[model samples]
Target: MSRYSLIRSMFRPARTTPHRCRRDIIMPFPVGRMELIVYAAVVTGLIFAAYHTTLMDYLAYQRDYIAFTTAWPSKPADFKFDMNVFLEHKRNLMEYANLEKSLMQNGTALHELKVAKLYKPLFTDIPKILLDKWVPDIERFEGVEEFLNATNFNGTIAEEFFYLEAPFFQFEHHRMAIMFPTEIKGLLMTIKIGDCYFWSTCHHTELELRDGDMHVLDVLETEDGQWNISRVYYVPAHELLKVRF
Candidate 1:
């Protein structure tokens, strides 16, 4: 009870209390099992969708790769490669086998003297001028209207034009934007060499001219010397080169 004793006791350190563990108190939200499951499923679905979309894109590109390597050994897949309509058609020609047969056998050439001639008006002035000057077959453009109407283009030049013009992709697989515009330059167009139309990517595909105008060993024969129609016989502009023993 002395003043000195009281001061010494006050100066002494107080006894340390034991540390208590705080329980992890989760906020008492009344979440049912179904709610938790639904939330988890949504998250999982989002992840799956993202992954699936990427996988699909990759698969589509690979499909193009296989087609390129198998069909066009001559044309390498670079930034500057374009496919002709024949090659494009060949991608799914089997589905349209009957139609192709009719087109090839019954309907004359997709581009005849008459079809190319009469169809000149639909074009802009520049194209009209170019077609008028370059396209020798005046009457050939005449029949395209009937042909397209009979076919799927509904009398529009959409289908027939796609056939004649050098290909730049027709929204198959995905979109035209998928391919760089520059990459389209190296496109081997379908050359109207003779009675047959040929897809020609010889610049990149390394197609060698054999005889007069035949590149793939000159298998096709036509009086006009222009390969006009893409037949099953015509080699794809891009294919694997033969290795000599």
Candidate 2:
């Protein structure tokens, strides 16, 4: 071929086969569709995993919150008093009380002051002598009989913790309350504040109180379902020992 003819031939476009072109190439399967389906499946799996993890965490937290808040079985009257549990709670109470006392004596920082203020009411120990008189089979403790005689008490204390199912005003409205059956049959003794906020979160619910609500402090004595509101003494958090009509 002449040089000019060879140059022209080199510049001419090559004839391509219809099926050989990149754009016209057909894969054996639907590659794009397969890729899309795989991507969607992966994304869905990730989303489900995230949702499941979050749901599990939430459920665990709810369980812990409920367990921490509920002091005993649903029915307080049916609860059998376990001395070991009571003593454990008592030790915890004493520890908190001591911590508060130490804070009061030595705490100077703002946080320390706040800590002392926050737990002061929750940590106060109920008088053991009063407990001896109120608690069933409390005479099992040494000196309970002598203390009872010394106080000149004649009325019989209730054998079990009386749970108040309905909300009532005891200083503040208590959605829940447990009373230590006082020797006086138809009298309301004192109701310790039972709010989770007032008692510093769920810590109070874990305590052992007698006449008290969630915390085992001295509370009122009532017939099966009747409350003698006339004699009820409600104590606020700030004024733990002070009597409010």
Candidate 2 whole-model C-alpha lDDT, 0 to 1: 0.36
State the lDDT at 172 in candidate 2. 27
* Per-residue lDDT of candidate 1, residues 118-163 (tens digit): 2333323112222212211112223333433433333222432333
Off by over 4 Å in 2: 1-31, 72-245
Please, what are the lDDT tens digits per residue for candidate 2 over residues 203-244? 232333223422333222223221111111112222332211
Which of the numbered candidates is closest to the native, going by highest TM-score?
A: 1
Each model's Cα RMSD: 21.4, 17.9
What is the Cα-based TM-score of model 2?
Answer: 0.22
Please report, as a residue range, the 10-residue window in candidate 2 with the lowest summed lDDT: 225-234
Looking at model 2, residue 82 earns an lDDT score of 57
